[model samples]
Target chain A: MTTAKRDTYTPETLLSVAVRVFNERGYDGTSMEHLSKAAGISKSSIYHHVSGKEELLRRAVSRALDGLFAILEEEHACAGRSVDRLEHVVRRMVEVLIAELPHVTLLLRVRGNTETERWALERRRDFDHRVAELLKAAAADGDVRGDVEVRLATRLVFGMINSIVEWYRPEARGASDREVADAVVRLVFSGLRQG
Target chain B: MTTAKRDTYTPETLLSVAVRVFNERGYDGTSMEHLSKAAGISKSSIYHHVSGKEELLRRAVSRALDGLFAILEEEHACAGRSVDRLEHVVRRMVEVLIAELPHVTLLLRVRGNTETERWALERRRDFDHRVAELLKAAAADGDVRGDVEVRLATRLVFGMINSIVEWYRPEARGASDREVADAVVRLVFSGLRQG
Candidate 1:
């Protein structure tokens, strides 16, 4: 992905580099010197682009949170039966996750030790609760199974979707985003046993 | 859980404190000082039990990997039809994850920066491949759906299962291990759509 020739480092470009290192070394583990080395820029130049490492973290997570929150506002997310709407959100989440892979990966790994991390975590919870409500609505409508609690099911479904960040490499010969998303929706609704 | 009266810090007890700190602060970010502080022992005293910070990480991941690999040896995991065996493994994975919550959480988060972390990542991949083969066998039997690639399906299911580390608080008012396992099996094999 980095093969495209680039001459200058924008704050956004610097953030992309910083996010990768943060993911490699934990956010708390990454230092300005590390970011400077990864981005091939000096420490002073990095300060010129963003306030510091915390600002970069805030930007990266904001990008991820924006992607997730946008899914809730889409026409498909709002205009269908609760189950169908939930399915739309799930499928879109996979697409968004892959598209914004690194940012989402960092978002999932945040521990609330710092102020920025705490904020990111709070936003993540709100997104989760929103998804949980959709599941609860589907269960109440009897369009989805009631035997499994909606809250637990929501977390597992998110778990399955989010785990893609750990394993999905864009260059690898894995299934397309849509294919993985379909499997998730199917597995979430059906039993593994052969009929 | 820690509310129970405790006496002295054995290597095992010190390890429990270390793992929690590792999870809270990423492994790379944690210092011997942090471990000492969390363990309530002086740095020199902590060394009396274990070698160093690396020792704690190594011990924690070993415990988690042992639990997972042990499941493959169970009679049910070995003797049943491929699909059933796969189901057995999947169900047991949830149980083991919940049973060794902190250890497994630390295992999943390893990034391979250090030698010990590299070993953990390699073993994690081996365990994943073993589960993938069971999934492949089931797909061959036309037991599990062939629509999704087995590798991707295996990852998504593992993603769902491994995600328990993120939120499966043993003390939380959450679903039982069996409940979570049943939901995973249902989601992995059948899916979310109503019959």
Candidate 2:
């Protein structure tokens, strides 16, 4: 009710709260009223920061996509032999996903319900195709297995990576991000079987 | 509605429609009215088969859980060398996931909202624990790498396997169920790298 309390919420802090609510209630289920309640601010105060829930979603998913797309532009991802470059991208992906867990979680769950959601899906497909092309190049280089179809391998590897968002908790005294990235890279390239 | 139209919905057929709607709208978002409309029956007609929407969720998750648990009970999973047994379970997990795609899809998306959802989450944990134990046995046998923690490895492997539900479409011409099962087994055991 106080102006001081209402004015304390920066857009970043508000976005963090909005993303959590969206993740919990689902974007479609979450309303501006829910955001206001969760953020402990007036609905008008929330509108002061962003236009609506869709804008928050756009911000969140764009952040996730940017992190992922940035990996492909990195030096390691670009300069190595196709398989090594693919491995670099995979390792960077785990790091990016863990770093941006809540945002990426929201990104992965968008089911094309709204225009923003559909745009997120389209960007996601573009990211997938970029990685799939990397897998194809690796296969053509005879560095990765050619027996498995490139598209299927790409999807399965992505499945392994993206599933990290489901259970990973940074605050939990579990594996460090480095340990996880190493494990994912090893499992993706070397299998679980002992060498 | 005509009597014949209402009478045509068996519990099995009604459950199918309910699950499809549940997957599309999500379990929490879906209501009895939604199920009734999706099934082309009255809400009372739905109640004739089961108690409510939660019952449909219970039934769907139970079906998915039943398929996964059945994999661990198979002879190959029980009697082989620890690594080989783990491999069998991984392959069968992919198969069960594909065979019961909608059921498992709904199962994976449950967020412990209601008693039924919480129960499903518990059962999923129990299933994960069972698979983790198999991975531990394999690591102890030296058939699989020991550098990665047993629990972490089990999760990543399951992540790779369980993700099949996200994108696998049996009706699609891309890969047969057999091809997918084979690809999963190969990736889990041998990895994406060529020898």
Report chain B TM per candidate: 0.94, 0.97
Tell me, per candidate, how large a share of the native contacts it keeps: 0.82, 0.75
The candidate maximizing TM-score is 2
User: Model 1, stretches more than 4 Å misplaced?
Assistant: A1-7, B1-9, B42-48, B51-55
lDDT of 1 by residue, A16-115 (tens): 8999999988898899999988987789988887889999999999999999999999999999899989988988899999999999999998989999
Tens digits of per-residue lDDT, candidate 2, A1-195, equal 467877688999999999999998889889999999999998999988999999999999999999999999999999979899999999999999999999999999999978999999999999999999999998988999988998899899999999999889999999999999999998889998997
Per-residue CA lDDT of model 2 for B7-39, tens digit only, reads 787888988998899988888779898888888
- Predicted model with the maximum lDDT: 2
- TM values, all candidates: 0.87, 0.96
lDDT for each residue of candidate 1 in B1-195, tens digit (9 for 90 to 100): 332323366888888999999998789889999987787678888888888899889999999999999999999999979998998899899999989999999998898899999999999999999999998888789887766777777777888898888778878777888888888777776666666
